[model samples]
Target: MQKALVSIAVAASLGLGATAAQAAILDDVKAKGYVQCGVTGGVAGFSAPDSSNVWTGIEVDYCRALAAAIFNDADAVRFTSLTSQERFTALSAGEVDVLSRTTTWTMSRDTQLGISFVGTMFYDGQGFMVREEDGIESALDLSGAAICIESGTTTELNAADYFATNGMEFNTVVFVDQDEVVKAYEDGRCDVYTTDSSALASERSKFADPDAHIILPEIISKEPLGPSVRSGDTQWFNIARWTYFALLEAEELGVSSANVDEQLGSDNPAIKRLLGVEGEFGAPLGLDNAWAYQIIKLVGNYAETYERNVGPDTPIGLERGLNALWSDGGIQYAPPIR
Candidate 1:
């Protein structure tokens, strides 16, 4: 079903001729000397700028990994901060080459939108956060409270569905941007702020008193947040998807940026293939044989990116509950390089 929708979009993209199917986006990026990545305006642990104006987060690292694969330099990427309502339009209109703004993969988006999701980078779920003083122990306690939510996101629908299912009634205060939602919630415009649990954690970290707010225990919906590209370029799609897989594969093979050089000398077939030591993996993707190597050398592996950005020690303090490796009893599994 998904393939059919992608085919329709891909066919539309190829309306010119066979020559147009070569994916000029990659060449365009190379000519510009940087990958244009769209990111959220100010979600701390996902994609936000520091005081130095440098962007850092799990999503930022994904874009950096793509730059490392192509330019052999992780910093060869730039970011455009986008609001939820403007993200897809920016990507579809050639304003950005890739969208790494913590977007959820949904059926309507997959089939209706002219974009294709690469793969899951961060697994999240819809959740609510309330002031601790409210004494709201559960979602059931918010029967008549007003909720602050961001527009043009799945959060609004999820909240509606959850409330209706639980026979609870609530008022909604919507904002076009996430920052507005957060500000309104902070200013006490609403009694509850609802969104992805990870985002709630990220937003709460920026509050004057982080401990004054608490996230409820209910997870309302599955949100597999990942990067995406405009449809119709198979080569670019493969490049983005494989770059993400390279991160996961590197982690699974015990490879990190600190030790990737040593792993290049490894005799294991899997390691050799992953490091582009014995396989012609990069030729198909129009990249160098050392493409994956450069990614690890510059951006590190999935575990490194996660731990450095939003892991247990970070301000977000997200644990590897479901984002861990499959071998470690989590669902973060990747296919073999071969």
Candidate 2:
């Protein structure tokens, strides 16, 4: 009798452990039938709506990739536009499953905010933008200029630190929304606009005369912008992290939405593992074996998404300098899927 009781207790404990290990995010999102993705109100090339109200950009692609991996449908995502101040709070309150806005991954944000930054989707730098006629070729030239910046964002702190470090004085015109900041800049209420270089490119393209503005050559600080999830959910964090890495690995392996099925049978060992040809990688993440295949098939790889949204050919016209693949002398590299 004693032996049977001990055996029963052990089996119950093991079952409980197994149940606890299941992904809460996966279950919640599956039950709801859609993922709530937080995005900026309107930051072109990162997250913006088209004429038909379809949200499309690098960040939007990340959210869709998550939905595709879980639900097998990229459209199983609902985008929630958030401001800088409301982003963290909204994410913390369970209002959004993931925050994929142009948020900087800093130490304070990672530690103090009770959120986990999954991985960098875009390698960016802080910079200044001014009217072409202002002759401000560098950030140093904006010593006493009035700068337009978004409040409650890393841009404000970065701007302060950059100016202070260089012993320059400047005035800041703060706004809560990107649209207001852009409008103020357009109205000449601010002599310059300071933000991430990618955002500068994005905002400039929205101007009536995009040719009238020029982003300065100075890049002040590194900004690794990516997805974020509420802390305490390790399963959710892993899903977001591995999803991003899968996108990068797909790009490295030349797997796009167009050719994902073909590449699933590739000779490369890493590609084989990533596409779930002969590995148990996705099992550990609480996903199916073809999880990566779903992501790449539905959302394409990092390069494809970047080119379509913000690359040199797009309105943003950003060159893939540091954002290129590692083999191409860029910093974008992913770990082996195996």
Best candidate, TM-score-wise?
1
Which segments of candidate 2 are over 4 A away from where they belong?
1-22
**Regions of model 1 farther than 4 Å from truth:** 1-19
- Checking candidate 1 for backbone clashes, the offending pairs are none
lDDT winner: 1
lDDT of 1 by residue, 1-338 (tens): 99988887897686634347556889999999999999999798889999999999999999999999999999999999999999999998889999999799988887778888999999999999999998899988888899999999999899999889999996899999887898899999999999999999998988999999999999999999999998878889999999999999999999999999999999889989989999899889999989999999999999999999999999999999889988888888888888
The pairs that clash in candidate 2 are: none
What's model 2's lDDT at 115?
Answer: 85
**lDDT score, candidate 1, position 65:** 97
Q: Score each candidate by Cα lDDT.
A: 0.92, 0.89
Q: Summing lDDT over every window of 10 consecutive residues in candidate 1, give the lowest-scoring window.
A: 14-23
lDDT of 2 by residue, 1-338 (tens): 99988987897776544445347777798899999999998888999999999999999999999988778799999999999999999998889999999999999999998788988899999988899998878888788899999999889998899889999996899999888998899999999988999999998887889899998888888999989998767778888889999999999988899998888779989889989998898878778888889999999998989999999999999999999989899999888776
TM-score of each candidate structure, all chains considered together: 0.95, 0.92
RMSD of each: 4.4, 4.3
lDDT of 1 at 226: 95
